[model samples]
Target: MDWQKNLLIAAIIAVLFMLVIRWNDFQESLPAANAPVSSAQQTDFNASSDAATAGDIPSLPGTTQAVPVANSTSTNVIKVVTDSLVIEIDPQGGDIVHVALPRHYDALNTPDVPFVLLDNRDHHTYVAQSGLIGANGTDSAAGRPLFTSAQTEYRLADGENQLNVDLVFQQGQTTITKRFVFTRNEYLVNVDYLIDNRSDSVWSGNLYGQIKRDSQSFHKVSALEMNPFLGAAITTNDENYKKLTFKDLNESEFRTVKQGGWVAMVQHYFVSAWVPDANQENNYHLRRIGNQDIYLLGFTGPRVEVAAGSTGSLSTSFYAGPKDTERLAEISRYLDLTVDYGWLWWIAKPLFWLLKFIHSFVNNWGLAIIGLTLVVKAVFFHLSATSYRSMARMRKLAPKLADLKERYGDDRQKMSQEMMKLYKTEKVNPLGGCLPILVQMPVFLALYWTLMESVELRHSPFFLWITDLSVKDPYFVLPLIMGLTMWLQMKLNPTPPDPMQARIMQLMPVVFTFLFLWFPAGLVLYWVTNNTLGILQQWYITRQIEKADTTA
Candidate 1:
């Protein structure tokens, strides 16, 4: 085999190795692994609401006005209402997303609510930790203090309606500006931080804040988790992501996952909270980038720290909206950060760029997927052609391989080596049949992740009987046709010569068909289309080879 083909096959094996490693990571991170739990973060916070200062934030009718603090320094006030959030940001340093918890939440339906009720005293905010981490590690105000700094200073805007808080850490030499955005819709309030360092030395810290929920029953789930392996693990923690809703896994036995970049999408029906990053020392979630598990998309990127006397900015866009993909995608890529394309981002990203481009032209994601698929097939045609020709040649030489094998049955390895020598001398590559398929796997998986995790395909349809492309293929039609196409292509070209291997290869179509039966319709569509295209190419190659053989 040529070096290029050899490298490609070797690379594919490496990729598969990575995939197997990723698959096993969950088990290793499971609590039974007995890894050490990471320690809690150490950072101090002094927060003051803008309600006592520049009260520009609009508030919902039911929202309570900001209760005054002894000495707060902030100049913004915001009110949150049902279906609306108010956010205020200072150009240089800080910003806030105002939240309003509806007064009549009890009147609404809730599957689970906590038994313990802890709302920090009316005027004071509390301390909470979230982001990619363990459940207990996520600990949102579990009766902990809302704010951490020992001493506090409060500055109210001249208008008396707005308040500004200047939180200074004696040891850290930093002051953070936190403001309360109020919502009349509910008791929930958004606290935003504009943290800065005035110290001569570099001040590095994360934004520490908290939300005090009265309910103890808060659990997490995500719109991005489409894999059964992941869903199985989370099921133990009480999840209802897709088809396998509320099916329990062995989460209690697992305890807290200790891997870093630990994120969990806690969903209780309509409401969901996110933990984007967790303390990795004790946290145990599989990695974010390499694994590209849907749950960890937003959990990606590095644990950032600011330079000496320099300000680093990071923002989280909280969605108080419904779980609808269309609604969620409308929030920004940041909000849909759970949509991961895996390692094929090189392919997936460009594909997304193309999909978005096609979407711009046609305004339909289904059509966009088709358009994107065609473009990809076209781009890969060069490599595909090489593979097609190799498969055709293999079929042509199959009789010769049988003759050689029968002539050298006593030494299988020697027979295979001589067969390969014959193949090389004849300018035929047996690997050519497999290399293209291997080459395409990364792109295929990237697209799978794209379609599986993307809100663009969520609930989007492509013609009849396939309403939600993000969900399982409803009628099993696409997968069956996919299998049929693959079978036809297999017949048109060639398979492994070993009887068992050939039989296994013959059954591959059926295996994949059954496997894809429950996959998203979009993925099935892509595979079916891919197989149909391959069938056409294989038939053409076969015809050309037959004519050449006859002429020769």
Candidate 2:
């Protein structure tokens, strides 16, 4: 009976523990509401020009004026299609204005519609911008240099491994070629500025890359669901990874210099980052545009000087795609941290790896979750057996405890003392059951994050009506099964001596069922599998203990 009370306390503590973590992220994920734009702000945000002011760009040592914005005119837009991506680049500044993932659909019902990541449409504004700034730079306060491309559209042909799209800008005796190199089945695009300066004087400029976006969430989150982080993340010299929310940027500008670290705009399951040359020192910055909801996260490389009659190039890699941990890791150091498993990433990483390994063989995410649950239970079998044995001993002593309660009806202190004596004589620890649950809390939380943060689970299907593992179960079947299994597991444990406590313990299953109804189906399936396995294990242990007592 005391063990049951401890079990209830443990369950409540576990829920509170997870809530504490989720609440912090939810607060950070809350973007400032889309504020009404003033007349001047409206003009600055005009969809037609889409140009950046000089203040929007990072300045060089001697150059006060900096970056320019790309014009969104149809004549300046170039469309490029590959196996995995459909992208729109504006030749005005050779900036990537829009990106759609052809492999990842916008919604389950729309099979042919691709998920748009970066868009410069009227409703939302998010785009990747890059340019050269400083003395002799083509981009200035006046306007961005308009480049010309051979064609307005390009498609990666079958059997082609790479596609190159080039935009050329020419000024007296100087030619600048902006080239984008895309590889098949890859999301990283190589952006290079090839400068040929035949002028008498040396040409000097600093290459800067940035992501500009409005502080508005693209995904719709329900009240019951945990809001994922939607902000900017970067790597620094002192810290491997750091996140800057739009609120933080609004409060104060963030500036740091590191030896070729990355800056990225991160969302639910996708990220876009600018990874500069690792060998060079770069300056990273994050700030909100003048009283507007717009935020910029970018980096400025050191100034490059091309001698007269010589040729030189500056290069940076831009990644826009799903948060694939392995691929991100290959792109840059600590870039995979964008996957964001919270503070317990050490535990989550291994769990994700095991799940992926299981999925590889089973070929189903649902089955992999079940297998992962089984493996976790197996790993904790000994500790669980210890707890169940203690619970079984308590169940055997339930009759004596009731008799003692009846004898000392109104003596609370006396009852407590006698209960302690009885527990001691029976060699049973009332707190034993709580240890197993407390010890397993981290693993449970890690699994929750793994299911939530993994892009592989998005739009993945289980059997029947569960078409999306990342979303709630359409039929609520898995959550109901989870509740049933939880109830069965509770039945295996000893009933509490107090009527109120017993009722409270009985209500846990119902409350959890309602709470889990809106949870992702994959997570609900895991709970069902775990509760069922626990029920079987506890039932077997209790039966063995009772049979031994009967023999005695």
Candidate 3:
């Protein structure tokens, strides 16, 4: 049947849709075949040879002078706990070496274990680093300044909305206080450098913040699963958002000067970003550290000068948490783009908004998905009706089409001519059955990305035996039902005349079922709902047309 050929084309387009959007990303992620393998041993923060150097910090706007690294020793670690965050700071640089989300679990089976977003262990080296750098900076090519905190650990008190953990470093007559202000239920931390210059000369330095991470993925995904972006991203004056893969950093350095922007390291469901003062002109940089696999993405604010015997403060914000679009947008202009819905963001955004709105009332993502499918179906009801009416008219002529095929057996050109005549006389569009699938392909793809990128859907439950919608259906029940609905939908349409084409069409459901077995349950649920609805509509339309013909 002509509908089968059109269906095959629609299926090919649907499957390759997302792949086409992410083709560049996929290419960038591919490792170079001739790339040299490093044999260096991994080291902890205290002894890591890939530590901060003068070259690591961005030079003054037009100056190329190198700043010397200070000679310092490692100090005690300061731990701070809030309702939403657990943070570990290295006093040596007042850097956030480790961060965990108390509200998010590391795994579904491990309720007590919080998800670690940043770590500085021997095996892993992802951490948030910040310090003063310039002619009068304390951090240098050799080492960073060692600071002292009032206590080894600090916890947010109940009923308190804000908590302050301060680390103090003394250099000659200058006292620099690094204060991290944490809110009771927020992931954004206010990092302020209160410089109390007691010396006769002025205190001048640039406050730089950066996230350093090795080119190692913490989350393991199968070869068949969709690989989320695991790299660096930034907002620039020219573009609202841009991404730099680890390989991109290795190939060349990325440098830009913008009034106010954010740099971040993005992963599957979470992100860590540094947002500088909106009024300050900051220099953003992304590059690999020497020949090592570690990459750094950060910004250096314009010089901050404190007069002799006076006090001044430089402030920035750091966010380490899930990629909540609304909260991220509140933090920076384009920070929310980190959620990354691909090229169909215009469509995906509204779909996500609708899904979220539905979930707000239903309180179940699965139910919300079904409601969303219904809304989408209703939106395209008239167009679908037109296509179904055409298909119904064709179905009424199926017996006649079979007779023509039998009469013109072994006569290819004659059969084609007769089929066209039949289609024209009956006013049935041979390709009309594919119109619905073609029109809905974008929505289908948008929903796929929406489900894949929305953090709220992570670990969300539907009903019995369906938990964690962000992952696959553990028992493969949804995929099986999705396949069954697909098969039934196919049955409602006229079978193809050619045996080989019919066989291929018959195997499509099986192929799609296996492909969807590893997809997120929320997405699979949406597909199943859409397919089931399609079957009902096709069957109803086909029945009405056949009954009318019989009556006539």
User: Largest lDDT belongs to which candidate?
Assistant: 2
lDDT of 1 by residue, 1-552 (tens): 234334644664575464333333121112211133343311111112222122211111234322222233234432222323222222112222222223213211331322111122222221122221112111122211123322232323333444333322223455544444333322223444444655676543333221212111222212322322222111112321211111222122122332222222332222223332333222222211111111111222233455557555433323332234344344332333333344565677666667778889987777777778788899888899889899888887888878776888678777877788888888997778777878787887878766755645654667777766767766778878888987888787765556655666677677677667766788778777777777787788778878988999
In terms of TM-score, the best-performing candidate is 2
What is candidate 3's lDDT per residue for 207-310, written digit by digit as tens?
99999888777455565677789899999888898998898999999999999899999999899999999999999889886676678899899888999999
Locate the minimum summed-lDDT window of 10 residues in model 2.
25-34
Judged by lDDT relative to the true structure, which candidate is superior, 1 or 2?
A: 2
- Whole-model lDDT values for every prediction: 0.45, 0.86, 0.84
lDDT score of model 1?
0.45
User: Model 3, residue 286: what's the lDDT?
Assistant: 92
Off by over 4 Å in 2: 1-11, 24-54, 61-75
For model 1, state the Cα shift of residue 393 in Å.
0.8
User: CA lDDT of 395 in candidate 2?
Assistant: 78
Task: Please give the ranking of all candidate structures by lDDT, highest first, separated by commas.
Answer: 2, 3, 1
List candidate 1 stretches off by more than 4 Å.
Answer: 1-208, 211-338
> Could you estimate the TM-score for every candidate?
0.52, 0.93, 0.92
Error of 2 at 4 (Å): 9.9
Worst 10 residues of 1 by lDDT: 288-297
Residue 351 local lDDT, model 2: 99
